[model samples]
Target: MIRKLLLILFGMGCVALQGQLAYEGVVLDADTGTPIPFVNIGIVDRGVGTISNENGEFLLEFRPREVQQGDIVRISSLGYIPRKIPVSLLNDDVLKLIIRLQPNPVSLEEVVLTDKEYVEVEDEVGYRDLLGKGIGYWKDSVALGGELASKIRVRKGLRRLNTLFFNVLHNPSDSVRLRVNIYEPADKWGAPGKNLNESGRSILHVLRSHEILTVIDLKPYNIWVRDDFIVSLELLGVFGTENISLSLPAGNLPGVPSHRRYTSQGSWERIDDSAVGFWLQSTFYTDKPRKANKPRQLRKREKKEREISGTVFEIISSGRSEMRSRRRGATISNYTSNKSVKTDEWGRFRIKAVKGDILGVSYPGMYQVLTKVEEISFYNFQLYPVKN
Candidate 1:
């Protein structure tokens, strides 16, 4: 009689295990039958979700009382079509299934060009220098890991974007791989919205150490901006080495607002205090001219007798007195010739000018200063803070 009771208790435990609700699955490419990683899986109309691991395997658990019969599970990825299956279709016991996603086919638009000349929409006048530091995935901070985005508006229609330019600085021992994504604004809140590129379509570049300007050709992608768009650079982490950091050169300028950066692949937040590095110089051309064009003769300006060198510094106001520090990445413009160059990291700049030639010096958060090139070789200027 005791042995029979023991057998009955073991049977009850087995039945309880079978009644638990759990789902485990592997995501793969439908055509190749290969594993796919980073696929987002979630319950339909429910916030519960998880992403596939590197091995393309995922496990989701539900309480026996909370799961419904007709509930749906959805899985989606960047380049594949999303798939959904009903909970009632799964097995009551340990449900294990293999789900496959088909590749999304992207259709390209036709291009027709009737004009050879193009106009510059935005120009990167090197002005400010700010470094974006790297933070881990979870920590909420400035210039951390994830994506940084900026907005650009197109005033005219039928303009095709030809090129994009930006700058980067990285460690000499490591190489960084990054992706450039263009998106249409979701709303007027100045946030990055839906991606404009087709599924899996992106511009990837490998960056090395030192300051270098990166130029990407967007013509093959046929990306045309109608009203305005957002440009984002995604840091995919460093390759070949570990524990290395990469940063982009950012600046502050009048008429240009502070850009936005997102952390841990999450929502977009504006960088309220400073402008993030990298300039977006977009060249656009239209097939038809909006107005008639007329040729005009250009005027020639006189040459300067000497070149002057200088160091720019910013005045930081404290409680009583003020302190001055090197103004890195300031723009020194020769107003006579309309030529400009950025100051080095040490805030030192050298430009050709005469005694009477005017030098326009400007940096973000400081008032513009125009100083006449005095008969001095080494001139120094201090930029005052803007009044509140």
Candidate 2:
């Protein structure tokens, strides 16, 4: 009986080893045959994923029980067509592949422009020590085509943009390349809308530490923004494989109100918890009246007007008794104006908001609720606990 048990144990071990799957591959550009780094590879709907290394090489491992026979593996990269393959087709326990990705075709739109000299319309300057975390593509999974965007409110129509300048704290030891993209705001939520720039290949070079002020010239590109727009910085590539651990420094500025926002999952969101703001400045030429061209003065006056006319609204939360303790820090944010406030210990909060503004209520373990501000004040919110 002991000899038979040992034989069965050995047989099970061999079967387990045979069930293990190891996949190795290199991602390359189909046209140039050059390796594409930081490609995102994953099993569809399985939540198992990995990124290719700097050399475009990747290894994916699956335990006997983790993978299904028909599970599909997906490979995707920015500006490249994504590819998918089935697990059953990979016959060998240890399989190798050289996957090629085709570059996505990009059409350049014609930019209409009237000749104009760019003037500094708006500026936000207050750079403290680097705030290690602001917002950007910092992880390998979202590194390719990863973007961070800042919302800039423009009161008047603009003829052309001159330049955008911002400071970056570079990792002096490593070299990195970044792309700058500009877009029109999609809606009141501050998401990126249409690509305003003709070419998305604008690159910035990071050389030294001590707050390198990178400038992006927009004159040659003929980009124009009428009202408000978003400026985004995209992480393109890190120079060497050894420098994979290094990330682009987050732009830091002294705390300013309602001007900072970022995106990591393709949707823009505000940065509220901290006082530091992302360092971003824009210079452009506006064709509107001189009064409309004075953004800083206009903003100040508008803020004062809002304060005078703004209505104070109270929010109340009613939910399950189990979730009452978790609703104290619920946040009330105005999506249109970017103003935010928090609920108090009693789940009550007051905010000065104007009509036509969209308000969102969010809590840690509750479903977020959005309501449009009307002409009245004193609003009550019903908070519901999130279903697991």
Candidate 3:
């Protein structure tokens, strides 16, 4: 009887010591209506805290007995000043806190380019002509108009992945990596650690300082696959740079993609003015089209003629009819009319070309070119080795 009584008393005591407590709030930029993310929030006295998710909301749980109405809460984050507010002010079990973070002042040292140092060409006419050409290749149709479109059937066999849209600055010497995060509708989705918000932030960090591309040609431009929304950092600066001139090929810029179906929301475009060039996104809308007709099986004899492969190198002005010869100990190669030729250890190669035929050179997607051959001979051609 005594044991039973003791057990009842202990249970009551435990219940009495516990109280229900919860903290909820919306975090926003004090200056703008933007929601603040990844900010750290904590109850200073109890040593408990939580970070705000992408939606700028945070929830922290505590036993009411462990926290009082008058405790102080601390909030902080990078690129922003921290603040503390009294718990008593957290009225009605829900709170709205507006925080303002000052932007970091950037200070770059002025660097001068001397006459001895070469400068690239940058004019509106040059790039405009280049991008206007039909540039890349898809499965069947050739890519055109600085935009590409293809009807993709999202069947059961297709992999499920997040759709993304991207735009870039082009230069000959740089490569940019872009990352994006998408947030699910807050009303319908709860905070998931692996959601788009974190992914976008991670990508932004990598894009801070990237290498730029110095040149471009057309052959590699056709090699871009449909899945690549990630723009290369190397080609970004080519669109426009201080004193740099961009020379586009005779046709259009290949591989700029557009939606095949009118159902898509829309895509992005590069907007340029006399002063600068930037990217703007368009709204994409699409309707479900009828199932596509199955393509007829192809005959084995009918094969694809397009072949893309090569190493990166520079073209020297030394050659009278062609680019300069490859240097010693080179590993790069160039595409010829009939077959591709690789450089020897000493960077020498004897390759064949036909008069009036086009010879394409390529390196990654950064640069490529198709040259019209006046004559086919070893004497007219040379190669440069690629270090990048």
Candidate 4:
């Protein structure tokens, strides 16, 4: 009976699922008639989805009670046209349906080169520090082609990316294959739009057992863009149970927001305004960035933001700039008062903490620290950057 259920779950048996609906199919190229692997197949925003494996086969099962009216299965892939089939029509078809996706490749026009004044500049940008624990399907099996992307700001003029770096955070699988994609901002919403990778070949990387940090060389692809763009990593295949996450704790890296799309051709959904946790090595022929707003002097700032009736602990950097980078917005939690406050530019924060109250401080790139309030005169706090 267990073997029979397995066959039914994989769409091999004729018996229909009791309380679930399963869509099984093999996605193929319409022109070449070859199996198209890693195709996205699922209903929009329903969280009911699956991706075609390397052989172009997939099985997507969902509870029929969970689907709302007008929901359709969206089948999509990079450089291919998307197809939608209504939920009611899927049950009418025979099991193991064959899907053909037409190629709708967008062309990149050739342009003539001209000599112009150019400044060659390069810098590294991304959320390298562990601000939070981890983001994504923290510890669960996820469909193939599920992507987690972060928006990266670039300078004016053309920018070329050479290296892309991100952390796995948690991967229960022994190995997981991933694809790197760089996209121009979508016109209507400024979300991840057109695929900027000119090469027809997919940019692929493999994370082996015990490996955490991943760095991919993008110099060969010659990826160049003028405006800000999004960098995303797509799940291709997992050797074991598919459990992974890219999010971190800390809640720092405020400006960059992360974006997510469940499967190939699915709609892009903004996960949160929080960090995306991916950075890159950027080279551009553009002028320096505009000067930022002048920072308010730390001492001159008004302390009247809140009334503090307890000891004031100054979080000083232990000769590391990482401590200062997160100084202004670092989180200071007063477990005693059941309240929290952000640190000022000088890494100083005042909270209501009496004797024996526990205080926890968090900053990017530094280990989280907790202190038990002692004598008022001995409240000196110092922190160092976290080592890799």
Q: Which candidate should be chosen as best, given lDDT against the real structure? A: 4
Work out the TM-score per prediction: 0.47, 0.43, 0.25, 0.62
Worst 10 residues of 4 by lDDT: 291-300
Identify the superior model by TM-score, candidate 1 or candidate 4.
4
Give the candidate number with the greatest TM-score. Answer: 4
Q: Which stretches of candidate 1 lie over 4 Å from their true place?
A: 1-27, 35-78, 82-99, 105-145, 170-173, 253-265, 272-283, 287-388
Q: How displaced is residue 356 in candidate 3, in Å?
A: 50
> lDDT score, residue 312, model 3?
32
Better of 2 and 4 by lDDT: 4
Using lDDT as the measure, name the better of candidate 1 and candidate 4: 4
Flag the better candidate by lDDT, 2 or 3. Answer: 2
lDDT of 1 by residue, 1-388 (tens): 3122111121111123455544677888888979886565666544345556657887655555655777777777667877776665555433355777898776666877654765433222222234443211211232222566766545554445545655555354356656677878787566676677664655666665643555555656766566677777765445565544555566543444434443223446665433445433334444345521211211112233466788999999999999999999999976533457899999999887666455678898897776666684997889998889
Ranking by TM-score: 4, 1, 2, 3
Candidate 2 global lDDT? 0.54
- Separately for all candidates shown, the number of backbone clashes (residues 3 or more apart, or on different chains) is 3, 0, 61, 10
Model 4: residues with Cα > 4 Å off, grouped in runs: 1-15, 110-113, 117-119, 130-137, 187-190, 245-251, 261-273, 287-388
lDDT of each: 0.58, 0.54, 0.33, 0.64
Model 1 C-alpha lDDT versus the unseen true structure? 0.58
lDDT of 1 at 107: 60
Q: What ranges in model 3 sit over 4 Å off?
A: 1-18, 68-70, 93-388
